[model samples]
Target: MRKHVRKLKDELVKRGLDAFLAIQNTRYLAGTTAAKAVIVPTDGPPVLICSRLEFDQAKREGWIRDVRAFSRWRAPLRPGERVSFCEPLQLIADCLRELGTRAVGYDRGGKKFVRKLRAAHAASYRELPELMLELRKIKSKEEVTLLQRAAKIAMNGMRCAAESVTVGRTELEVAAEAEREMRIAGSEGTPFPTIVASGRNSWLPHASATRKHLRRGELVVIDFGATWGGYASDMTRTFALSPTKKQLTLIGLVKRAQKAAIGRVRNGAKASNVDKAARIIISRVGYAKFSPHGTGHGVGMEVHEPPGLAPDSKDILRERMVITVEPGIYVPRVGGARWEDMVLVTKKGCKSLTA
Candidate 1:
């Protein structure tokens, strides 16, 4: 993440901003969700500000060295004794003012906070959401390593869930078993709720687990991901309670769609073209209407990010960008099937992490 911070600083300099201020809750700063803040200057080490509640832990786990305890609110005014409450982000404003920061960039901040910054220090601010997103779109080597581990855990969960599918087991039970395996296997948590949909339920693309029991000759779709070290891996697999011609055909078609799309994922590939690759197969199978969503999305700290793989997307794939190649066809009574895999873009081609 040192390189990420350094690149951000470069962008700040190019924008004529003195620094970049990122709050913890935004989840764009260092892939952290802790209740803290980070201020990165163009020419110096970044500073981390932690509230009293998060101070000790931040000091232990934070990357920045200049960690400071966030200042507390002043004692309540003594019956109108001519004292004023602390301004919004007073500590942050004071730090910037002392550093002579006349301009700053941020991913997101409230109006009140921006107003206080301008009023207290005469500092101007510009939005850095695009810059942040661009930085996050390409996965660092370390981030990809973490995501590779996450993908392994998710693959194991899928195996467990597939084995648990039987005539008597409810969808909820299968999902629970998969979730348990992920947790037991060292996953910090799940990116999203485990999904185990069977029979008619499979027709609903994002269906959650229900008490409905599985039965023979039905389709079952399990979609889930594991979170490790704040990175996520997403995948989906379809199973059959009992083999049938139609269900098997549906699964084959989805596989073909995924293969066609994943083959197009490489550095310099147009994201929309990848979507078209998948859509061509589904449309050829006469199930295009059943596919409602995009083919895939960039994945990392968040389950979904930029560089969308869809018909309307203008994003282009870049080397080291990890994404999900998910293709599905959902039909009502005929049942539905979807297969997804986590892949990493490469200069020559892409590697399937779930393979």
Candidate 2:
């Protein structure tokens, strides 16, 4: 069994759960996102339940040995597996009944799943609060390697952006160029839509790329992320066309703020402290109003996960936790500048994965 599964099983025992159902976070436990649901019994081997179409793929990629399928297209059955055609919900309930589990735990994503399972099974279903988050927050050595590869791909995309962005080029054109480069560099896919905002559009933090032509002396914010092997990396870089003094200053301040936030990412540091470290730097220069978003967020299977670097966040930093330290300044009618990078939290400090 994978270490992730062992950790979950240990937690299941502590919570007095006979079995734990996973609809989401299947990728975290078993390196495959193909499984629709996974059941981890406290005393027996875990089982992966996927659609018949995905059965072969999940069996090939999953770490666990027991993989079952539902919603028929009739794949070859394993030894002693007689039932070949069962509805997904009935199969799930049957599996729990076979395990003789009375109390089952499930993630937040299993609300509807549990409701349906309750109608079919007599097992008690309860939510496991932050169970997957706690299990996936820490990066194993292999997970870090995958994240590093993702970061390298994202960096290649940014380099493409630098070469492609020029006066008169449409924002969409630049974004397309960067995305193509990332694909060529071996990214599984983009974690989120690429953000290539120029001029007034850059003033919006989550601005979508448009057909607007890039103008001289306008700031361009390119936020992009690349995924590899179910891991993700996020990064942002600001470019100036003709280079105004204000644009340069904004870039410099945001960069410094990002650095400050990253410096506070060591183990045991509070997530709010990291956000404050960046906020204070930008606020000192009277750009506090211009900075609306949080300092950053955790980057993993999903681009935005846990351990958020925001003022109201209660998460604490821990070693091997991968996160992004992003700081930005957006002035209305002027433009916006953001600096973001993925970092790995360590005991002494954090290492930049997307420098």
Q: Judged by lDDT, which candidate is best?
A: 2
Q: Which candidate is the best by TM-score?
A: 2
Tens digit of lDDT per residue, candidate 2, span 271-301? Answer: 9999999999999999999999999888889
State residue 278's C-alpha deviation in candidate 2, in Å: 0.6
- Mark the regions of model 2 whose C-alpha exceeds 4 Å error after superposition: 72-83, 109-112
| Residue range 282-351, candidate 1, lDDT tens digits | 9987888999999999998889888789999999999999999999999898777999999999998899
Q: Positional deviation of 17 in candidate 1, in angstroms?
A: 1.5
Number of clashes in every candidate structure? 0, 0
TM-scores of the models, in the given order? 0.92, 0.95
